[model samples]
Target: MRAMVVAAVVIALAAASPVLAETVACHLTYGGETQVIESAPLASPYAGTPTAIGSFFLFRIIFVREPADLARINLYVYAHAEFGEAPTPVQHASYPYPVSNHGRYGFTGLQRVYEPKHESELQYWCEMRGA
Candidate 1:
């Protein structure tokens, strides 16, 4: 009976623990382009300044691939506004476990929360990093 209990406890523990899988290719679409970012380190085409969008800026769009039967992806979106001075982060949001049925996802129309007083340019970028 004791042996059986021990075996049951071991089985339970094993089931409770999550299994880590190898990193896979994940794609992020921003600024009319799609780039591949691995699960190892964050990677993106927009490494430097953020891209421009009218008077607002797109900070970044990062996608982290998850270990699931389907193409489950975690999407991270960030945006900021600049008014001649240093840029300030306006928005930061995350969508967890977004299933990518077509192996692709796109996000747009990120409205800037802060409005600049004078004529300013909006900058943005995208990146992919480890989950």
Candidate 2:
């Protein structure tokens, strides 16, 4: 029947792309407020973008699950825009894929990133989930 054929095609597609189920989550804290950002595996890192956090920080996470050798997660922390200017990157971190045991990786406790112009500090750390 047509229904059976459609089900078969769906199963075939799922089997061919198991990596679609993977995801990464990053936790960010600044100005006494905490936020979590989650990212799914991407086809291209360049497709990712940073998120605004509070009034002083911007955060971005890139998770890629293809090309086995290049599978990884990348984190970027930046100073949020001031006076309509672009956000400024303040820190970056990278982690390899297959993060075992839902592993927690990032700063020991909390780390600091300083905004270049005013030397203001931002705190952050991240963990991988559903990896």
Candidate 3:
């Protein structure tokens, strides 16, 4: 019984480790269709540019602050839409954060994107700061 409990604890810690390692997070949503994101893009330490969209349905990202971080959470979004001419983004939001940055902080995020018109060739890039 003790061994099973310990194993469960180990798995929980392993799952939470990734959130502690990151400083930025994001969320993206589309109006329709389900989609899949290939990998997590690193916004710091290295430059990331995901600009390749082909036969895409929908892709989005969402982020939240880990309880341990104890800092303001920020989110970023990068997406491309498909269309006869070009997918026009309908809206953009600039939400506010409650407190100031705690210096060393991290975030976790996911994205949802959609490409109905083109259904192909939908890609983009974005970042966030001072959540």
Candidate 4:
């Protein structure tokens, strides 16, 4: 009976603990190809790096989990040249914590962005799992 009580207490504590592991996966589609980028929430927004997509775009997703009120996710898309020219910011999207998923699921739905110079289209959607 004592062992059973201890086991119950342990289970209760575990259930009350906060979820420290979360994954935010983004599906990126461009130029007839698709790519997925998965990331866990970071303590700092500056910890993320951009990934090159094809010859014209650099994409980045940053998830920051701080205080409950301050948690957020930011997506950045940049227009980049294969040459030595600098990358120019094209699109930026910010989603606050507990994103607007009415009842469907964790998916945030499809979002379309465009590059200013070439007017190229980039499509992406993101799903968040865990807390």
Candidate 5:
């Protein structure tokens, strides 16, 4: 039936959508002079305690507006920080950025975000406003 076909199409769209949640808790940490981001807004940012989630699929940083000011940022997991830097964003808008899974240690939903060059990693990102 036409109705059945429509239902299938809807289901397909949902599957294609990126899975996510609201308010992703990004743990920012830095102490050494190079720790705090050097730019406008605020100075000297540090890490916060990890947040707990019962269960979910995956978590990523959905920037309301990507942080183009960030010189470097580190994703915390397994007591290790992966260093990353943003290279002058050509444009500014909301975009989804993926957070790699670190086995048992990972957060779900959109938590953190920073500017990326030419948005080469966009495919891995999800929708910021909603999952």
Candidate 6:
């Protein structure tokens, strides 16, 4: 049936595409420095929620440039992990002077054990400019 064929095609296309999460505007700050990076809608997936690793939370971040931009730019990404009412810095990572203007870049911070026996939170930010 025509309806069946259309459904099959839709399923095939969905399977071929990569799963993407919402893109959020973030302010990255580190060592008395701060910057904001605007990401394109439908851009490649960069970061995800921290995963539980035993008694610790593993933080991660991925950065990808928009395909429309041909200019090479350096991107600096920072991730902060915290627990309890007061956030305590647990990890810091960055990608400096990327060779390519396009593609995926990633960083994984050192695992930090959960404190106060509760789930931790993650904050992300980045700065980008011409190399």
Candidate that scores best on TM-score: 4
lDDT, candidate 4, 1-131, per-residue tens:
99999999999999999866677888899998999988888888889899988777889988887877878988898988647888898888888976655333245578787877777888888888665
| Tens-digit lDDT string for candidate 1 (64-87) | 443333333333323343456655
The TM-scores of all predictions, comma-separated, are 0.31, 0.70, 0.23, 0.76, 0.23, 0.27
lDDT, model 2, position 116: 77
Q: Candidate 4 at 8: error in angstroms?
A: 7.8
Output the lDDT of residue 42, model 1: 29
Candidate 5 residue pairs in clash (backbone atoms < 3 Å): 24-110, 24-111, 28-47, 61-112
lDDT by residue (tens digit), candidate 5, 51-72? 2111111112223323545422
Cα displacement (Å) at residue 90, model 4: 0.9
Off by over 4 Å in 2: 1-20, 101-109
Q: What is the C-alpha lDDT profile of model 6 across 17-68, one tens digit per residue? A: 8766433234433333434444433335443443332233333344444564
Q: How high is the CA lDDT of each candidate model?
A: 0.41, 0.73, 0.36, 0.82, 0.30, 0.39
State, as a TM-score between 0 and 1, how close model 4 is to the true structure: 0.76
* Candidates arranged by lDDT, highest first: 4, 2, 1, 6, 3, 5
* Top model number, lDDT: 4
When superposed on Cα atoms, how far off is each prediction in RMSD?
A: 11.1, 5.5, 11.4, 3.7, 16.2, 13.0
Q: Cα deviation of 122 in candidate 2 (Å)?
A: 2.3
Per-residue lDDT tens digits for candidate 3, residues 37-107, read 33342334223433223333323333333333432323333334435554345223332323233333312
lDDT of 6 at 131: 26
